[model samples]
Target chain A: MGIPIYPVHLEDPKLQGFYDGLAAGELRITADTETGEWVWYPPEIVTGRPDATLEWRTVAPIGSAYTFTTVVRSLLPGDHKAEVPFTVVLFEPDEAPGVRIPGVLVDADGIEPACGMRLRLKPVRAGDHIIAGFAPAQ
Target chain B: MKAGGVAITGVGETPFIRGSDDTVLQMIARAGLDAIADAGLTPADIDGFVVNQYTGHGSDELAHVLGTGERRFAAVADSAGGTATTGHALMLAQLAIEAGLATHVLVPYAIRSTKPGGVYAFHANEPHKAAFEMPVGFFAQPTYFASMANRYAHEFGMTEEELAAVPMTYRAWAALTPGAQKREPMDLDTYRRSPMISTPLRVADCCLTTDGGGAYVVSAVERARDMPHPVVAVQGIGLAFNNWPHGVLFTQKPCTFEFPGEASAQRAYAMAQVGPDDLDLAQIYDGFSISALVQTEMLGLCERGQGPRFYAAGHGMPGGRMPINTSGGHMSGGYVPGINLLIEGVRQLRGQEGQRQVPDGGNSHATTILARN
Candidate 1:
């Protein structure tokens, strides 16, 4: 059996920028004006009040695993066979507040994920495709 | 506050079923008609409509199917796994009534159970769907909640059996509710032996997808006083949003049943001028067992990390201190797009819920507090 695969098209310019930055080895942080709070994945506006402000800033790509799960089910289309028993995680950036990103966990076996596990990002090139995953701290 | 006061005058619900051949419009129309009739009103009395986003049907189409004309307020809200729509609709109705834009409002939702698959794929298109959060499989609402449950279990030395008890207890409650989907009772052994859909969450731990509809008629308090049923005033309501950034996830303390849900509950309680003890019954959204446990703590029914013990003590059952989810909740009551939870709370308060009626003889005009995440 092959690993299930799917593609997500990026739409939001800010989100596209974030993903593009991740693919290019950088991190971006932005503050929501409506809620007067900072957020990741670049929210449109802070939710409550209109006229919300948003400012983007670049930051280092250092974070840790807040929580994770080993997925036994497939949510994609095709089977890759190379990736089975994959792990998905919610990674919390070190310098940001209430900022967490979700990505795959590489080489995650034999080690259980906790609420605050120190993790670092590793970019992998899978056949011309660059993807990010969490690895145990060096 | 001449802004407008909304009161629930009529409520209607379809028998919770595993699946129905009826279209989403049919379900909505059925529930709407029943609700209108219950209110002793007609389609012409309704001038506004509110519905859930992606409810497998359109609100405009539903209004058309019900032969509603000249809708002053028509909206579809997307609260992202949170049951904010109940309060959202209430606020909308209040505004419409206050603005003299509409005297009567209909809040309805319908779900088709034939599609067993979740709607995570479709939700990706939502504007607020976080980009970084998309890559991970946290797409499903249950998964995010399951992670919390997993953390709760790990930190507090909680057991799957303890987690399983919440749903098992609800299943028992549903057994008495004729309109519930899973009316059959299950023992602790059976609940614990169920297949695990997610760690710390068995198949029985989650709510069942079902074909159903829930509708309510809201009007100004003065107008509602003349209706058939006694008016259930919207004493107070509040909504809160927590949009923390990515790093907060790691440094933030695990929710341990105490922190996250409290803010919303406090706002709601203060607005209602009622405490947890004042509630006659509660219809907390129980998308999952652990979610219900967290809600129990958040609603101030019990202390943080004391949910399992409170539940074990039979405090959540009927005749107990807090008779919660009297309509079996989403877990056993049949998942009716989460809106049914609101209607059930009203039903319990109105003493219309037979068999599963609360201990107060279902008479004393009671106050119901509904919390959703």
Candidate 2:
């Protein structure tokens, strides 16, 4: 039999906002917690602090490229064909207490993602799914 | 500096190989025997046993194979990979010594490379693995680290040339280590063009997978004084975890220097009463080049985001401020699990590195801190 699939449930409002932002065009969002401010991924409660105050706030989508890697092979099936190389990048947003976000590069040609290149987060719709991606800032 | 100290008296390792005919049981026996012999003890003296469960070898089975008369302690630790193995082993040895549970403990790992078995299957069962991660084809560790590597490069303005410098420098040290699997020098251009297993990481950036075992014996300092080798003391150790929420995948802002590593280093240095400047040599784990860089910063050797610059400036090389991974490390040295790094640290402290020895000469005192990513 194939692997069993489980539906992930998100209950926290902050986390819900994070996924909602991903679904919408808001590629970058920040969360302020009592321990400290952080960015959400598969969002949830801030770790360590028992009484963490997490709030979802939107910010500028522009970020500076921190690092980038080109993947020649897909780790998952149907993600990308063998010929199409995928570029994964860590983009540092231009906000206070700079946050690093990981995403894929879309529409990047000839220009290789470098350590300090500026890029903008581009949220796209894959069928009905919302995914965040990075492209060189014009 | 005697609040609570443990002594590492004996270290042994099986030669790393691409493929081996020996079963996991056989590897454990061989490595365990060598470690006990290194400690100048017999199986009767081993009161405790510690091993990594993920390696597929069971701790109870290992203790039975070694023929311990009446074992006082047996532990199969998870969560700590290579560096954690050393830290946990030392911790258990110290506890046993103090608690009157057992005087001697053997920590061994027998992992078979080239054979895809054991915990690799467990990854398929993880909730995250089945859901968001595996569906994206992020099957193995390379992809996870590749994502981080890309982010590190984009955030820090680091270059492949700069990134390639870490493995290149490690290979130089490995060249001096006769036991190293890949001892040849690696040039930058060759490193840059190396097969890209994942972006920001190349074939060279990753640690080699090999079949081997590394084991060490620990005992109280008084008991170890009678042994042939000088004792390498475990001065301090610390561990932390990244509790990033799932949806915040890309934005989990972990400070390489500040999180588990740096915090752990601070505790270790405090316990040892030593600072980064006092380190005669180090055996930082190099599972990946960025891992080494992150660890160096966390260990207080350099400032945040300064690891690449420190490596680029040749500060982490053999003759530099703090000679690191003198045993060739996991990067160039065959990965016999992580016990080799600890063994190398002990060897460096004992002045056994020979040509790979640091220029400042022999070291009577050393501290080894192991960090897992």
Candidate 3:
């Protein structure tokens, strides 16, 4: 099934790095440059420390599924009826222990998606752009 | 605040309908009037107000519509969902009443879920969700809770039957609740037949799409002695947050399945000088079965990770030892966020809910309470 088509708002400067990394075929997430701690979804300002700066750095593409759901109904705003029955996985990269990246599962012929299931980043094309998709790892 | 310092003197709600022409403001006005009248007072008698921000109606707007008297104390519940309308609003109302800032505070909330945009529209428009989640088709409460259900089952070992028990328990009570929205009988087979929205989360597992409103009048417990209802006083209340804003709540939490209900529950139980065993009944916020399940454990209704088993064994069903969501809850009752559940709690405590009321409701004292997250 095709992924649901919704415009990724690249207008937010913090989120632009994720899509930019997707274009380069690498998995990158935001982290504090000074502390080197992962701050996910790239908050405009760190929780308490407003002065802390965030930087996008590439990490290991291979990861394990933290949690997943096989969406039988598309909750997207528009008509995404044809995009039913897609499994969305929150993949935790090997490098980022607690951080999870949302992606659609792909290239699993007979593999079942479960927590702690091994997966690797596999970007796939949607309607007009590519999204972070993952395949079962060896 | 001290126990029995303030009490819910009156409660009212509009009929929970699917396609009602009532706007949010209209519904609240009607419900607010009903509550005011129930307290044997006109709108002009109400002085304090606790208005919910989610209603998109300000204190000035509510005052104007209801024609209430001078508002000595008026505050807004700035949080969202049940946390704002139920937990935070009550805390604020009691604080004001105890501080002598005001008495006769009206806290009202209503929802037009069937509005121009459906219930899921709000989630679709979130900036972080639009950026990170929607692209992968991960949007809406069902999809988000569905993911949490999977993680919960994996950790705690939940069977499909165990999960089905959650909705089944609530529907059993709804059958006796004449005012409940979906009162048709629902068994295990019927639950299985409910269409699946996401893995494990069927339509039965989600809260109903309700267009209705509910409001309650809070007054000093001493003032409620002359009011028309039994004193369902504010014995204990608690609310805690980990800075988990709506944006990162679904995805970035260390353990997304775990809501911070325990911390709040512990604090509330302490304040009341009571334990979970002391509760005669409870009304947990049932936004989703997975959420209700975890909350059931957090509220100490059952052992942690045994919520499914607790319900499957008929612990929360009618006449069970621990009666929960006595008015069918949001799942099968009405979804006015926490307001309806609060109304139901008051009704049950008042012993006016014909057949749905719990037997010997409480200890003739102050052991009963509603625990929210």
Candidate 4:
């Protein structure tokens, strides 16, 4: 509890489903009910049109690493020191278009990741919070 | 004539130093008082105002302490990053003058980046930071920009020395600047040897988190004629928001390295009635060294994918084909938000930068860029 960091308040009404999905080991995102567009990072409403509703859709738990960085230094205080030199990646799911999400590349240290390398989602618990991450596809 | 009837009459700033003794209020107030005095006006004459976020007690506290009359126009600018803060502050002040809301307007920006909690303060505050970004270990701005720099280098085959030139030029310029924080002369060797903050971003490539504040007085063109210093005209201005998804994450793009400033720059140039060729110098925001390169390209200063080559060819240096970040920019000048760059633009236009002055003492026209990532 060095910095008192907390995960997304799944307790909130708007984001309850996203957190519940993570807790349940299901990866969910939103798609336009009208335009058939997949939205990553789970938008509350369809982009650009407030009147349109975004429907929750369960997505494949696998993606490809689009781009990433190897953090050699720790910028944050506390338990982050042990996490130095970890890899953070922006990944594109196989099902989404123009939508990418970010997460730590679990167990990716010493691994030279090439673009389009397949990665699968893994949700782990930190303190009382559940965080999403990715591991190289076996 | 982008937004007419406005001219920057005076620019002032407290020393750009790391771990300064001044409090946030003191830093901003000192700069504001100096600017108002430089404009040859008093607090009472300042009818309009805008300031970057310091805390809740911003506009009213400052106005009261300055002993000003009825506050005709006073508001705080926040949420947007540094560049947008500067642009919106200026635009709001411009609108105040043009719409007869106020005769003279004041815009002030200050940051205590060197404070123990300064850099990470936004983590808990930005609505999305605490939950989505910080929990995943994306704790600071540098890592976010570093990803783009890495991708850009990989895609374009930009050599390490070419990337090194970005900070190298700024450090050289900063040496000439008296109060600049990192003014020591830096050669390619020093930059190459600097510690890596993140992959593809060395320590020198990131902006110094120093404490400082800057303020500017904007007056009608008629009032500018009667002022003491040469007029730094607000010739043109433009602003663009993160229209794409995920804001700074920029997940909407097939290539994540691109900056979204093309539309903003085009709009500003259109309003100014000048193209990139007509610009004498640019003070584009350099929160990260690579951002300046991307912004210069997006602003049409050079062709896309030519930024690395442009700097490597000895452009953007003093007396080079293109003059950029002449006052060391945020890298050396201290991140006084983006207002310090605006101050540098005014100083260059007025032929006031002593050693770092561009050739021709700044041509007949000048443009200072404030771009958000």
The DockQ of each candidate is 0.24, 0.26, 0.80, 0.41
Best candidate (score: DockQ): 3
Q: Which residue runs of candidate 2 sit more than 4 Å off their true CA positions? A: A1-68, A75-81, A89-103, A110-138, B1-4, B117-124, B134-139, B244-259, B359-373
List, residue by residue over B1-373, the lDDT tens digit for candidate 3: 8866888888889999888998999999999999998888889889999998878899999999999999999999898778777778888899998898888999988999999878877776568888889889988899999999999988999999999998999999889998899999999899999999999899999999999999999898889888877787777777877788888899999999887788878878877777888887888889999899899999888899999899989998998988888889999998989888778877777788888878766521112253210
lDDT computed for candidate 4: 0.72
For candidate 4, write residues B83-192 as lDDT tens digits. 53457778778888877888888887677777776676655554444445566666566777787887787677678888888998888778888888888888998997
Candidate 2 per-residue C-alpha lDDT over A1-138 given as tens digits, one digit per residue, 9 for 90 to 100 = 012112223333334564576666775455655544663443333455545666667777887766555667544433355334666666777873456665666767778667678788786444345445667898
Tell me the tens digit of each residue's lDDT in model 4 across A44-137: 4455788876667778888887777767765755546555666777777788756676667775656686566789988766567877677889
What TM-score, over all chains together, does every model reach?
0.79, 0.79, 0.97, 0.88
Query: What are the Cα lDDT values of the candidates?
Result: 0.66, 0.67, 0.86, 0.72
Among the numbered candidates, top TM-score falls to: 3
Worst 10 residues of 1 chain B by lDDT: B364-373
lDDT of 3 at B269: 83
After superposition on all C-alphas, the RMSD of every candidate to the true structure, in Å, is 5.4, 5.9, 2.3, 4.1
lDDT over C-alpha atoms for residue A66 of model 3: 89
For each candidate, give the TM-score of chain B: 0.86, 0.90, 0.96, 0.91
Better of 3 and 4 by DockQ: 3
Displacement of residue B78 (Cα, Å) in model 4 is 4.3
* Local accuracy of candidate 3 as per-residue lDDT tens digits, A1-138: 456666676547778888888899999999998899999988878978999999999998999998999888887877888877788999999999989899999987577789999999999888898899999999
lDDT of 2 by residue, B23-47 (tens): 7678878888898988888888888
